[model samples]
Target chain A: MPEVLKIKNLHQTFEQGTVNENRVLRGIDLNLEAGDFVTIIGSNGAGKSTLLNSIAGTLPIQEGQIILKGTDITKLPVTKRAKNISRVFQDPKMGTAVRLTVEENLALAMKRGQHRRFRPGVKSQDRKFFKKQLAQLNLNLENRLETEIGLLSGGQRQAITLLMATLQRPDLILLDEHTAALDPQTSITVMQLTEKLISEQHLTAFMVTHNMEDAIRYGNRLIMLHQGRVEIDLAGEDKQNLTVPKLMELFQKHVGSGLEDDTILLA
Target chain B: MAIGVYLTFRILDLADMTAEGSFPLGGAVATMCIIKGINPILATIAAFIGGLIAGLVTGILNTKLRIPSLLAGIITMTGLYSITSRVMQNAANVSLLGKKTVFTIAQNWGLSRNNAVIAMGLIIALLVIMLLVVFFKTEIGLAMRATGDNPQMSAANGIKTQGMKILGYMISNGCIALSGGLLAQNNGFADLNSGVGTLVIGLASIIIAEVLIRNLSIGGRLLTLVVGAIIYRLILALVFQMNVEPSDAKLASALVLVVCLTLPNFHLPRNLKGGKQNARSTKD
Candidate 1:
């Protein structure tokens, strides 16, 4: 399969030219093949989310070229980039409108590109399609189409958000610790749902997570980012058989002794 | 007439200011057309268009200029003040006392002037309410509401939030201008300063309506806003009837607004504490 996303010599600096100037990503290069799932692991402020934002066109890159499906998208604005990419945020509420009903939210997502038409919300067929999609989550949300999304638990909302993000099956999907806000049990369910959807849709996905176990367990490839550089990139059987101890050994070797915090090693 | 209807207007009134200019602009344009020998009904339609244009200006300033929404409204209103005055041939106020006002036309059709004014107001209000109710049911409308609720999510979902904001401001101000226009025609004149302090009255009405109509339904919420506006006007009339000094009217209105805004803060619900704690933790 062809490369779905390519990032070359990417650099992002916050507060550039000021006293508080901080360079987040420096001379980064990455390529994602179509239908490839890549899990990125890093400590706080490791430029994980920043990298995702750069690709999604939320944050402007100081220097780099981002090509999505062979088209240069580095200079594209966030709204234009949204046509080819979909994102699910850490907070469940961030991905969906709380005040609107599930059906209404789905309708907005469905009308993502064709916004000029002034038609009444969700047709009966669209409602049925949404219902079928919601049923796939197995969260009993199928019957609750008219229920306000605010009434849903965080886990349920995240699942719905996952479903919505994949509704159109864009060229790339970005998941920024989407299940981080839920409880452990709910997180497990959401993670399962995430994996299922990514595989079923054969989507090219990039997910950033703090959990080392999840990084090792899910996705076909695992990458560890440190100081704005990719320290480890393991794939295929190597990534499949990767253990927590091996990841810690690799992290210590590449990132030096500063990341020896117990929480990180245990995570 | 009923408490429910009264509360509906209150919710609507909460979102005021743009309405001040809009309402009077509606009245001014309608009256201007009537003066030019246009039919009373057609004049009302012209008033609606005028209000829409004012709203469009405010929307453009907010979205294209990136000015804050409230500030955008204020700028449009101030500009409209001058434009409305110029449109009326530099007269700060124009009276339809002997002209073919909507009221006069209604009277010619055997309706009393007071009855005609009330009927006209009701008709215009109903049309606005109906259009908005239907609009809110559409995909664009949902996206527009979502823009207000969570702009980031709307943008992330590929919705053009800037365009939606502009469209929202336009619709809101358009309704306001329509109200203003109708008010001018009903009262037989348009005054440049009539929109002054009108935002406060609208806010008071919105707050009052929300308090009265606690139901969270969308239709209930919009209806309450309109009712709140009417109740707000009735209360003002009652206050005038109580022999309150005309000079202190503005002061009283300001006082009412201050109380309404501050009252909700002192009585935060217990459940909200958890959300606040979550917010604090997130900051940490």
Candidate 2:
């Protein structure tokens, strides 16, 4: 398996050298290979979002290195690195341009990391291709190609966001609490869609979530972060027989404290 | 000029205060060139380029220096005032009483002055509108629009938002300056203070156009802006004919703009889109 991404000794601190200083990520190391889908679970302020932001180029690297496909990307701006990395944010409205039509947004995603030339944005011939791709989402979005994305429901938008993220097959996909705001049923549907898309594309992904069952069920590997460090990293057979209660027991034994109710949900 | 305002205000989603400065800059540049025996066409092109540079300065101030957009425009506009004055040889008003202009060139082709102005105006407007319509349909134009709509989404999709903004400003100010050059030629003179109330008048035209047409594609919307400007001028003429005093023109423009801008909040049946929410306040 070829390495798709690598993070070495990643550290992030807010308001450094002050009374309000808070270290989010401390001396973390991570790597992902082709087709690896890793789900990360952590309590609030456990540096989950920071780790994801660091990899996605949203947060500036404080004192570490990020290598994507053997290329150093620690200094690249978000837009510069966006060609190979796609993200689905927690806010549904953050993914797609609200005022743009579904097809227009798809067209934008299709040109990700490519220079925009003086060509027609939505070509007459490309409309057929967009329709074909959109129809596979099973959201009846094919007919809504001309409709503004803001008119769609949150689930629909998230689904479209996921579709856009995978439109051109990015090198890595980052999912940061992507469904935290949706209703539980819609969250389940979107999560399932997320899984379907990842598997269909054989993509390398990093997903951060608070739900224990979701963290366990969706991806091939699971990681639990405590106090800014990866406490338990499990994969393949070691993750198959795990349950929520047993995961909590592992957390308690490793961290010497019961799992915070605020962080873990039994349901 | 109004078209320039439309790009910054409606498309770029930034209210640029550089209009007043750039407008006069164009007028002065063209007037100076014409007075120097330069070809009218070349002078107008130079004026347009002058406006582009003005836009570039504001773009740099806003994007690179991290100044808020309005302030960036203000800084550039204030600096352009002096530059424009210098271009006009330190004169507050430069007369072009005997100079040849695009309209005069049309007049030499066997047409009355009135018909010549109308012919040239229509031709230029037609050309500009056609070019803009085609440009907006291009891949780069779509990305520029998306940058205005959602910078975050644009950045996520790998669009360089700052560069888009800079390009938008250049295009917008170029159009504005060209308009100033044409108007200066028509009026036979350029005045330093003529740029006052320019933004309000432009906004008034845009809002009037939107009031008349509720649902339009981007091309349709842009076409209506010209119609809106003509109607706005007619309304002002009517008010002046009613003995409202010519000096009250700015007040009239401001009032008209205020009414048109607020008309959407009334939810007039014909003015509302299918899924229209509150009035769009893309004022800046």
**Cα miss at A103, model 2 (Å)?**
2.3
Cα lDDT tens digits, model 1, B5-89, are 1211221111324565666677678777878889877887787678768877877777789877667777877778778877777
Residue A30's lDDT in candidate 2: 88
Please give the distance, in angstroms, between residue A205's alpha carbon in candidate 1 and its true position after superposition: 0.5
lDDT digits (tens) for residues A1-267 of candidate 2: 999999999889999999999988888998899999999997888889999889888889999999999999999999999999999999888888776778888899989999899999999777898888878878899898888787789899999999999999999999989999899999998999999999999999999998888998988899988778999899998898888888888888999977666445443
Q: What lDDT tens digits, residue by residue, belong to model 1 across residues A191-241?
A: 999999999999999999978888889999998888788889999999988
Candidate 2 colliding pairs = B14-B284, B15-B284
Per-residue lDDT of B152-244 in model 2, one digit per residue for the tens? Answer: 879989999999999998888888888899999999998888778787878888878877875566778888999999998998887778777
Evaluate residue B31 in candidate 1 and report its C-alpha lDDT on the 0 to 100 scale.
Answer: 72
- TM-score per candidate: 0.91, 0.94
Q: What TM-score does chain B alone reach in each candidate, compared with the true chain B? A: 0.82, 0.94
Q: Which stretches of candidate 1 lie over 4 Å from their true place?
A: A262-267, B1-20, B104-110, B261-284
